[model samples]
Target: MCFRIVIFVLFSISASMAQEPQEYLDFILPLIKEAGKELLTADNYQVEHKKEVYDLVTIYDRRIEDILINKIKKKYPNHKFIGEEESEINGISNLTDTPTWIIDPIDGTSNFVRQIPFAAISVGLVINKEQTMGVVYNPFLNECFTAIKGEGAYLNGNKIKTNGQTDINKTCFTYELSLARNEKYGDMYMYRLKHLTRVIPGIRSYGSATISLCYVAAGRIDAYQCDGLYPWDAAAGVLIVREAGGYVCDSNGGEFNLMDPNYLATSTKKLSDEIMAIERIADEERIRDAKAKTEG
Candidate 1:
């Protein structure tokens, strides 16, 4: 009898430990979904900013943050949360490996403010500074993209794997237009845009980086390119894209670091290589032009 009781207790402990990560997701997803619903109904949300023009936050953003923090604190008292608003308010700090939660209460706040449904709630969990699990909920579209490291990625609870379309013309692409508004390269941005537009059959510019990456993970799009994004904006989506068996790298074709402010991601390894090759050619052209003018 004593041996049986000990075995049962051990089994119970193992079960509980295994459930922790899923428990985190289960706890957070509903809150995010609820927040999304609230956003749809909110008519009085106003822009609240940390910096007058460069950074943007909204009342709905704060409300969602409050909801997330309250739930996270209540459920996991020892866990640390790094939210966009809190980070902006308290000043940014280094991300530690202590079971940190990275959140963008509402990614694509400009879209949200303008009554566009391209916004989403992005939640990611990191253990020892490596992203382990992420969930991006777009309530307006009723799409939920989730990934657990090594377990694969899913959309709406259905398994989603990157599709195989190695050809460029058959591929679909999405680009982030946010940075182009203040594009540092001037018309070089237009050059890349023109180049990509000519190649891909479909080219889209969606305001949500997280959602855009999710689309890639789900095979809705084949690639994504974006610049000037913070960690919170890309962290969850990066994990999703990677877990979906896609390739994610910096614009220079380097390994992806979550903290890096630039990224280029694609649904297939071959597609990424091709896209990077095109980007390099365009960059070379610009360099050659600059050198020619200097010598002249």
Candidate 2:
């Protein structure tokens, strides 16, 4: 009986210690720093159009991604990867229970190309299909935000927290509305933008979703709403916001998914609920507008 109890206890302890987010965070710090240094020194970076004329990828994107994936693979041969460039060719990797590393080498490729300092090399670690840790590094701006599942979020080695502003009338917000330039997504984003504009003082659009989320995590912004984001784009930033004591949820006020994280992240749940209400109103208005147009 004593032997059996001891064995069970050891097994439980091992299971609990199986996947450590801090361990993963430690491993990634040097890698992102290395990538950052290269980015800062890089000039004459080659660029190519992805899906749209404005959607661009630079040579640094691939090079930095390869470095992260290769280094991580060397350490954890069994780990999986879902990277921006790699997904463009092989498609997104399956999100299984196995440990996976999500990588976005240059989240703001356009910003990087345009010499904007908002670009970041973002990464997230998922264990058992749940985001357990994340890191977002903007080298040009010298900001690195990090977080683990239970541990608090941090920026530049200092602990961080959301501002926790609850008033709907006093919210500062950001989103990606450039997708509206494409006809297929225009109404979907424009309607929400119109409603949001009426309530908020002025809207800010950072071409980089990673930066937007990081800024929210650091309490630099009160709320951020984004849609049509890939896993890598939001995976790291979402975890950072959540760990910073912010609320991250689906745009429809549903449970947020790390795999498809088209989310509304806010400093507080009350703020999230308020923004969600505005979004609901925007949706209804959009439906009415579409119906009227068709009837006309």
Which candidate wins on lDDT?
A: 2
Estimate, for each residue in 1-296, the C-alpha lDDT of model 2 and write its tens digit. Answer: 99999999999988767556677888999999999997899887679988777678888998999999999999999999999999999999889999899999999887888788889999999889988889999999899999888888999999999998898778889877775344556777888888888888757889899999988889888999877788998888999999999999998999998777778999999999988888889999999989999999
Task: Give TM per candidate.
Answer: 0.89, 0.94
Per-residue CA lDDT of model 1 for 84-105, tens digit only, reads: 8888778656778788888898
Shift in Å, residue 234, candidate 1: 1.4
lDDT of 2 at 83: 94
C-alpha lDDT of residue 16 in model 1: 89
